[model samples]
Target chain A: AQSVTQLDSQVPVFEEAPVELRCNYSSSVSVYLFWYVQYPNQGLQLLLKYLSGSTLVKGINGFEAEFNKSQTSFHLRKPSVHISDTAEYFCAVTDRSNTGKLIFGQGTTLQVKP
Target chain B: DTAVSQTPKYLVTQMGNDKSIKCEQNLGHDTMYWYKQDSKKFLKIMFSYNNKELIINETVPNRFSPKSPDKAHLNLHINSLELGDSAVYFCASSQGAGGSLDTQYFGPGTRLTVL
Candidate 1:
């Protein structure tokens, strides 16, 4: 079984400020990592993912994540954030198996303040 | 066109009632999934089906049954729903189970409120 841990439950930042949402995973077999975002009263949308061939993966809305295998971390970062970026962020991991099932973290709420 | 669509965007019913949620994906994907978002906003995979075959069935209660008549549609039927069953249910689909990576596109989700 695979599990993900998001260290931050909530993150507050002003507009245009840099931010980082930490995520870690524990799995015996190989795994794929992903980050998803959900606005108020909406379904989840994929932010970025780390499959292979690249340590840094860029996603929509200027968001990116770095896959650190040694540290078992896939932290999401944004150089600058806008007010519209305020939403709930989730970190998820799926085993190398083709089950298409994912285990998600508790989620982190990013509140971009004015 | 919508990649994935779920009916009854919001469902509110008393406890012990029976209800169903319909979902369809026009993406022609072979795999579809159902995920639940609880009050804490934690998303958990409840079921996964491929080509009308059950693949992943989590520890969800038997009252929450999922039926797939075809590859493009997956419907969830809840018998005697409980208060704990109140949550946002999302339907998602991907090209295949083991593509380069499983990138699933999700529907807007149907919120269920049990009173």
Candidate 2:
């Protein structure tokens, strides 16, 4: 079993400001990590994923996440944010169980203000 | 063309009533999943099917039954809905299981309101 913990429940920032959403996971085995974004009333959209290899993973909408194995963290970052970036972000994890089931975090609400 | 679609984007029903939500995926994926998002926006997996076979049921109540007639279509039938069931239901699909790292595409989601 795996669990994801998002340290920040809400992040408020002005437009064009840099931001980081922290995520930590606890799993017995190796895992695959993912970040998803959801608009006001829309479903989730894939932001980025970390399968293997490199530690730095870049995603859409100028978002990037670094997978630190030693720290058991996959923190999402954006150099600059826009007002349109106001949304909910979720961090998920899954292992090689081949079940295709993902354990999601509590979610972090990013409020980009002007 | 929608990759993954769900019917009845919003469902409003009374308690003890039976209702069903339909989901379909045209991405030719082998795996389909159902997730529930609560009022606080907590997303949790409810069920998963692979090629018309039940693969995972995450301690959900038996009242929530999922039927997969084919690889592309998966329907959820809830018997005796409750107020706690008032949440957004999302349908998603993936190419395969874990280790593949295939992204799961999601539908628009069906908001069910049980009164």
Per-model interface RMSD values are: 1.8, 1.8
Cand. 1: chain B TM-score: 0.96
TM-score, chain B only, every model? 0.96, 0.96
Q: Give the docking tier of candidate 2.
A: medium
Model 1 chain A — which ten-residue stretch has the worst lDDT?
A: A94-103
Q: lDDT at B43 for candidate 1? A: 93
Residue runs of model 2 more than 4 Å from their true location after superposition = B97-100
For model 1, the superposed segments whose C-alpha errors exceed 4 Å read B98-100
Writing each residue's lDDT as its tens digit, candidate 2 over B1-115 gives 9999999999999999999999999999989999999998899999999889898899999999999999999999999999999999999999964223778999999999999
lDDT of 1 by residue, A46-80 (tens): 99998888899999999999999999999999999
Candidate 1 structure quality by residue, lDDT tens digits, B1-115:
8889999999999999999999999999999899999999899999999899999999999999999999999999999989999999999988875343868889999999999
